[model samples]
Target: MIKKLLLGLLALLLCATAYLLLWPVPIQAQVWVAPPAPGYVGPHAPNTRLAGLQMISLGAEEGPEHVAMGPDGWLYTAVGSGKLLRMKPDGSELAVWAQTGGRVLGFDFDAQGRMIAADAMRGLLAISPSGEVSLLTDHVGDSPILYADAVVVAQSGEMFFTDASTRFGAKALGSTFEASVLDILEQSSTGRVLAYNPATRQTRLMAQGLSFANGIALSSDQSQLFVAETGRYRVWRISTAATGLDVRQASPQAQVLLDNLPGYPDNLMRGLNGKIWMGLVKPRNPKIDNMAGKPWLRELTLRLPRSTWPVPKAYGHVVAFSEQGQILADLQDPSGAYPEATAVTETPERLYVHSLHAPALGWRPNDLK
Candidate 1:
């Protein structure tokens, strides 16, 4: 009986090993070397500046991913519940501005004072002043806009946005978080940048081959578009007039503005004095980077318990940089009290911090000139 039990135990161990090593998974893992992440020092050193961030609660509606100001000066933000909310700058008179019935990850206003939104489930949308929601465009070529992450309306009535992934669209994959994980694990570079022309009512691809395109911002002169490619930890600058460009290749007109950021870059908001504010959602994980060259290992990791996945620990961080890619200031809270500091919107009086998973919007008094 003891001999039989030992043989059964060995068989079980072999089965477990086989399951871990040969299980079919969703991700098509790739091999690419990830740069070493720099430690938090200098301007990124630990500080309490963001520790005491004041909050404007959303009750059960959480995850203020992106915050914007309307032409009317009211504060606008998109929450996780597929609701667009508006509140006074002082956090008074909180009310629903519009309901898109789909999660809006990012949004911006057009020259005509219309609220243009990048809805992860609904594609590009234009929300009127009276709270009417309209779908702008959803498909490019034969492919639909899978994960519309961010939108920026240009002065010419044109719209530019980022499709975060093609392989695991939010509609097919069920959730942005799950889709992102698959895309990052695969690293197939299926993400792309696109543009919509209002007059023509047509959407066309601008650039392709990004791992996971996230935040977007127009240059001060409105001539260039700065995109945050999160999966690869870089920011790309592309010309508005350029079409069908590949960001991975060397080009003078379109190239990486910031490369190998220490953390996962989230959103881009134009701030004071020609500076663009960028949020770093989480610090880099060396273990994940080390596995970049080992595709099989990455696949095996996905087969493990989901909790064993190498998701980076939460660390509150944000930075400001110029169009030339010069990092101006870096703010950090290593304790991660604020949670997923995804972007920063600057007003003359304050700097509002946006998050991807916080129950409230975090803001602090702005003294930076």
Candidate 2:
């Protein structure tokens, strides 16, 4: 009986080894050199500024991942439920604005006062003030946008937005969060930026080859564009004039502004006083950095149980930077009372912070000095 059992155990071990080595995983991991993590220092030192966030109940809704001030003066946020929740800046009179039927990671008001949204599942959309949602463009030329992310509307009625990853479609992958994990692990850098012209009803590719392009904000004069590349932990500035361009290629019009951030950067929004705010959803995981060059290991990791995955712990952190790449503000809550800080919406009196999976909206008095 002992000999039989030993042979069975050996057979099981061999099968497990083969599965780990040769499983048909979703990602085709690419080898890359990860930048050394910059521990919280300099302008990114740890602080409790984001702690004690006054919570605003979303009732049964959760994950206010993107918050923005509507043209009509109410604060609006897109929840995981595909419902846009709107309320007073003080978190009162909460009401549903419009159900986009897709996850809107970012949105902005266009010249016509329409909400231009980058919906992860539905593609780019234009939502009228009266709550009617219309599809704008899901494909540019022969290629379809897989993950529509942050968007910024120009005064000329042109819309610039990010297609977060071409290989990982949010609709097919079950959720944006899950697709993002696969894309980042793959490191194929298929993310790109595109421009949509409402007049011509055409979408044009702007740039490409980003690991996971996330947030986007246009410069004051709308001459420059800032983008957050999440997996690489950096923000980039690309000129609006560049079309059909590869950001990976060195060019005067494109450059990295903030390099080697301490955490994974998410949404980017223009803030008060010429500042642009970015949130770090999770701190860097050393294990991930270590595996950056190990393509096979990443594939093997996928064969393991998800509970053994090296996902980092939650930490509330946000930073503000100038177009010149100067660190203007850094807020952190180490306790993570408010998790997955994705971005911030600033009003005169309240600083509304957005989270990816928090149960409610978080805010604090605009009392920062």
Candidate 3:
């Protein structure tokens, strides 16, 4: 009986090994060296500045991912339920504005007061004042725009946005968070920035080859774009005139403003003064960085139990930087009462913090209330 049990155990071990090595995962893991982590030093050192953020209950709703002021002087946010919720600035008179039926990760008001949305599952959409949704563009040539992540309308009625990852479509892979994991782990860098002209009804590519392009904000003059390349932990400033630019290659048109960040960057929005705000969605995981050049190990990691994945700890962090890349404000909450603080929507009176999966909307007065 002891000999039989030993043989069975050996057979189980071999099967487990094979499963770990040969399982078919969504990602085709690629080998690339990740930049060394910057470990919360200098301007990014630990702080309690963002601690005890005041909350506004969404009642039954959650994940107020994108928060901003609409053209009608009302504060707006898109929850996980695909319902657009609008409330007065003081978080009063809450009402359901409209439902897109798809997640809107980022949005902006066009010159004509229409909301241009980068809908993760529904492509680029235009939502009229009466809450009617229309598809603007979802494909370029033969390929589909799988992940429309961010949108910013130009003065000339042109829209600029990001397609986070072409390989792992959010709808196809279940959720935005899940698809992002595959693309970042693979480092295939299929994300791209695109431009759409409302007049000609044309969609064209501006830049490509980003691991995961998350957020974008136009320059004051609209001459340049500040983009968050999430997987690389960097923010880039690319000229608007540069068409079909490859950010991986150093060019005068593309420059890395912030590099080797302490965490994975998320959304970018225009902040108070001449500053641009960015959110570090989650801090860097040392294990992920260590496995960056090890494609085989990365694949093996995917084979492990989901709970065993090396997900980073929640640490609320957001930064305000000048157009020149100077760090202006670094707010952090080590306790992480508000997880996944994505970015700040700054008004003259308050800084409304956005979260990817928080139960409530949080805000702090200019004086840090």
Candidate 4:
């Protein structure tokens, strides 16, 4: 009888512990998904009709962040080793164009064939076809460009770029995003967009109060510019026309073009077919998104090392969308291309993808009409 009584007490104690552990929590339990297999296909349906989704090696020794096509038909890309590489169309030969003082992020070639780059540590840079590097601007107004992220060239020679965050540099991007959630919970702003004039060699702030201003792309007509606000999961369109500018009477009033994306959007480029191609570093983990509503949870996640962090398998995709924000196709790592594909640029013959951690470049040849 004594043994039976002891067994009953033990069972009751276990039930009490379970109740205490789960009673205080109001949110649902987070579900963890396993990482994708070496050759995992995405859940989203592929637009098979849209061709040119293959992966080709770019022969880089380190991570490549962005790719741009020059007027000479050569592919220009920025690698994590702080070097710019110029590769032939077939990815056969490569030449180190310029070695910046820091990591290079985004780049675009001007009408004059000069390459303009947004270097994370060295600020804005200009590279000649002959591989000479020059520092363009380091600051806008009095604030230094903490993390110059992306750049675009206009027909008039004006350059637009994003200073991703004032709180963190490019080296700490992962941490910066984590900090952004905390700041958002506190309702703070720490990002900006700037413009540089080549003729006068002047840099000035064009927009402020951005969560994390990223890729900048001008509209086909040059009447407006789209700035990717990564932290807020949206793209903001800033007016460039005289009428819209005059009405705001301030830094361009940003209008949301797309919001609440399934993933964090990175480098954006205008496709040859007149669509916007965006690279998603990773998809939104619902647990992380929910935690972002709470500052403390966001802070804790940020402190965790990337290796220990629980990431969803549904991340990593290159999405193509129309100018009006219609999703055209969702291109994934069909051949297990890259772990973290960060940027995409289209040339007359192919589409190039840059990986953040992978040592090589991925390419898919275009379907000739």
lDDT of each: 0.90, 0.93, 0.91, 0.69
Position 159, candidate 3: lDDT:
94
TM-score of 2: 0.99
Q: Per-residue lDDT of 260-317 in model 1, one digit per residue for the tens?
A: 8888888999999998999999888999889889999989998889888888997899
Residue 118 error for model 1, in Å? 0.4
Q: Write candidate 2's Cα lDDT for 58-109 as tens digits.
A: 9999999999998888888999998988898778999998998889999999
**Least lDDT summed over 10 consecutive residues: which range in candidate 3?**
360-369
Name the runs in model 1 displaced over 4 angstroms.
none
The sequence of per-residue lDDT tens digits that candidate 3 reaches over residues 1-369 is 999999999999999999999989878899888888889999998999999999998989999989999989999998888888999988999889888888999999988788899999989999998888999999977779999999889898899999999999988976988988899999999999999999999888899999899999999999999999998999989898878898888889999999999999999999878989999999999999999889999989889998999999989999999999999999999988899999999998999999989988999997632
Q: What is the C-alpha RMSD of each candidate to the true structure, in Å?
A: 1.2, 0.9, 1.2, 7.8
**Clash tally, candidates in order:** 0, 0, 0, 1
Better of 1 and 2 by lDDT: 2
RMSD of 4: 7.8
Query: Residue 142 deviation, candidate 2, in Å?
Result: 0.8
**Model 1 lDDT at residue 14:** 99
If ranked by TM-score, best first, what sequence of candidates would result? 2, 3, 1, 4
Residue 141 CA displacement from its true place in model 4, Å? 1.4
